[model samples]
Target: MTKLNLLLVIALLGSALVLVRTSYEGRRLFAALDRAKNEQRQLDIDYKRLDAERQAQATHLRVEQVAREKLQMRTATPAVTQYVGDRPHAASGVAR
Candidate 1:
């Protein structure tokens, strides 16, 4: 009877230790998951901000401003327009 009681106590202690270890690990994993979710939210915000910046940079007015200021480009005007003649072969609709 004493031997049986001793065995039962040992089994209970082992089970308690296992439970404690599992609980700790579960809390650690939960904390990690929370941190990952926060990181994901921050990344999402960054992506949205960058996308807005990209859209602003790609606007037509912005493009024209950059072209005129940096590249010295100008819009086409009727006074400066020139007409070109098509190739003779193209006009005849035959391959050369």
Candidate 2:
């Protein structure tokens, strides 16, 4: 009878150990999943911010401002422009 009791106690202890390990692994998995969700949320926020910045930079007015301010460029005036090179000229009197 004492031997049977000892065997039963050992079996119960083994079952308890298995249960504890399973519970621990489940909790760890849940924690990792939570962390991943938080990271995804943060990345979404960063993407939105970058999209807004891109939109602002791509505006027509912003492009013109950058061109004028950074490159110091301006449109051509008719008084300062001239047309040339419309008609072809004959070659000089030299053999080919």
Candidate 3:
């Protein structure tokens, strides 16, 4: 009877230790998951902000402004326009 009781007590202690260790590991994993979720949220916000900035930079007005200011480009006008063809008089429809 004494030996049986001692063996049962040892088994119970071992099971209790395992349960405590598992619980501690679970809490640690939960904390890591929370930190990862926060990081993901921050990354998502940054991506959205960058996408908005990209859209603003790609706008037509912004492109034209950059072209005119930085590239020294100008809009085409009739006075500056030129026409070309295979023959000199091909566009005017006059026989050579």
Candidate 4:
């Protein structure tokens, strides 16, 4: 009977240790999950802000502004335009 009681106590201690370890692991995992969720929220906010900025940059006015300012570009006007016409070939003298 004494041996049986000792065995039961040993089993109970082992199970208690396992329970404590499982509970601790569960809490650690929960904290990690919470941190991951917070990080996801921050990433989502950043993505939305960047998307809005991209949309703003893609506007027609913004594109034209960047083009003219950065590229020193201007709209085509007839005064500044040139046209070329096909002429006869040098050797064959034909406008094929």
Positional deviation of 71 in candidate 3, in angstroms? 1.9
Per-candidate clash tally:
0, 0, 0, 0
lDDT, candidate 2, 1-96, per-residue tens: 999999999999999999999999999999999999999999999999999999999999999999999999776899777878668768889888
Error of 2 at 27 (Å): 0.7
Could you say which candidate leads in lDDT? 4
Question: Given candidate 4, what's the lDDT at residue 27?
Answer: 100
Clashes in candidate 2: how many? Answer: 0
| Model 1 TM-score, all chains together | 0.80
Tell me the tens digit of each residue's lDDT in model 3 across 1-96. 999999999999999999999999999999999999999999999999999999999999999999999999999999888977576644666767
For model 2, name the residue pairs that clash: none
TM-score leader: 4
lDDT of each: 0.96, 0.95, 0.96, 0.97
C-alpha displacement of 49 in model 1, angstroms?
A: 1.2
Provide TM-scores for the models: 0.80, 0.74, 0.78, 0.87
Clashing pairs in 1: none
Q: Which one wins by TM-score: 1 or 3?
A: 1
RMSD of each: 3.7, 2.8, 5.5, 2.9
lDDT string for model 1 (1-96, tens) is 999999999999999999999999999999999999999999999999999999999999999999999999999999888989876753666667
The order by descending TM-score is 4, 1, 3, 2
